[model samples]
Target: MSKITVLVVDDHPLLREGLIKILSLDDDLEVVGEAGDGETGIKLVHECRPQVVLMDINLPKINGIQACKVIKEQYPETQVIVLTVYEEEKLVLDIVRAGANGYLLKDVEPNTLVQAIKDAVCGKAPLHPKIAGKVLHQFGQMAKALDMNNGPLLTNREQEIVRLMAKGATNRSIAKELFISEKTVKNHITNIFKKLEVGDRTEAVIKAMEKKII
Candidate 1:
């Protein structure tokens, strides 16, 4: 089998080297490049076309969130896994919105980090337990708020779509997960927007949280 090419982007030289060393031990993975900042990371991504990127959120120049956004926009096929020490809810949400495939804390077990890279390549989102818990807690709070507010009741399917949207899943990913066509996902989103009195996905998510529709 072919190796999964990877790029390591972090500001710390020691951490970057350590990651490369760890990933190198996995026969199925190859560290093809490294960058110390977000700008260079993007440049290396374009140059190397790695299948996976291990990115640090607090990088110099553009910062990892912006780099992830640009990389995903320019090369949707490339998967980015954020490796950082931050466990803040807002940062987690921002990284997801920027199209990161996974979020792992800096202290993650070596084996778990390796597996996260593999999972990302398989189109699976791997979020740190703390980060995932925060997202789930937020969702749960929204559900409870919806109950208390007596907001417009959404169908089970619509609620599912809204939940997925809040998790930052693309329409394509949502369709695949729901076993429906992309067109169907779009239609559902349209109905959801109308019901929630929102415009786009971001606005819909905000409104859903504010109104507790999801």
Candidate 2:
């Protein structure tokens, strides 16, 4: 079996070294490289081509989310698992939108962290239970709004557009994924905006979530 190669990225020297030490104990995992900041992390990830990247959100040069975006954009095969002290829902949502596969807090046990890495490598998202609960509550609020109407609404295409837009995907990316022309996408977006009574993508997504359209 091929061992999983991982790149550790943290602004703190001790944290980076500590994560490497923790991950090194796993027979199936290898710490291929380390970076003290996000820019260097991005460079290392590109150079190492690791299967999994354990990254910290608070970095020096750039934020982890931006680095994840760059790395995932250039190397879609690489999986990033955010390791940080933050438990903010918005940050979690942002990182996920940026293409991170998992989110693990720094307080997580070494064994659990190792398991998260393994899960991420296999394309599974692992979130702390508390974090997951918070996410569920967020979804539940949306669900409640969606069920508020007498009957279900929103066509499948509108739903798709909202989901992509909510995740901060570019119109071009959405068009490619939906296999629609850019003009067609713009047309659909306009229609979606009109139906949602929203003027822009951000507002549209907010409205869609409130209606459980996504």
Candidate 3:
């Protein structure tokens, strides 16, 4: 079996070392590289071509959000998971918009962290429970403030898919739950994005909430 390659990117040396140690314990995970800031992290990512990256949002140069955007734009195959202390709704939304595959708080347990990395590599959006709750709450508030009657109405299937997406379900899991193929799920999601006028799952959920479609 092949191991998942990971790049640890955080400004704190001790935290970086600790994360590397924790990730190294899992036989299926390999810590291929480390970087102290977002800039170097991007550089290492290009060099090492790791499948997954554990990134800190608060970096000295070109914060994680920017780095994530660049990485995704340049190498969409590489998945990024934001590992940060901040759970602010704005930061979470920003990271999501920047194309991070997952968001985990710094206080996450070692086991959960490892699972998150694995999940990200499998195309799952592993958002911390607290962060996910906050995002949902924010979206709900925005929805309440908007006029729901004005936007495009989603079909029952699309609405269901968006609800699962809000809960951080991956395409595979969504397919399993809905009793459909992953390809069908992808097709539905593409339609959902078009109707919602959003680019990704996070934005789709936000838009769905804003339009009260889910």
TM-score, one value per model: 0.71, 0.68, 0.89
Question: Tell me, what's the RMSD of every candidate?
Answer: 5.0, 8.3, 2.0
Q: Alpha-carbon error at 169 in model 1, in Å?
A: 12
* Model 1 misplaced regions, further than 4 Å: 142-214
| Predicted candidate 3 versus true structure: per-residue lDDT over 1-214, tens digit per residue | 9999999999999999999999999999999999998899999999999999999999988899999999988988888999999988999988888888889999999999999988877767898999989877887788788886978998999889988987778899999999999999999999999988877776687677778888
- Model 1: which residue pairs collide? none
Better TM-score candidate (1, 3): 3
Off by over 4 Å in 3: none
> Which regions of candidate 2 deviate over 4 angstroms?
143-214
lDDT rank order:
3, 1, 2
List the candidate numbers ranked by TM-score, top first: 3, 1, 2
lDDT of 3 at 116: 91
TM-score top scorer: 3
lDDT by residue for model 1 (73-122), tens: 89988999999999888888788778787889998999999998997776
* Model 3 whole-model lDDT (C-alpha atoms): 0.89
Model 3 root mean square deviation, Cα atoms: 2.0
Task: Compose the digit string of candidate 2's lDDT tens values, residues 76-171.
Answer: 778888888898888877886687777888889999999988866654567877777766577676578566563336678878877876565667
- Candidate 2 yields a Cα-based lDDT of 0.80
Evaluate all candidate structures by whole-model CA lDDT and list the values in order: 0.86, 0.80, 0.89
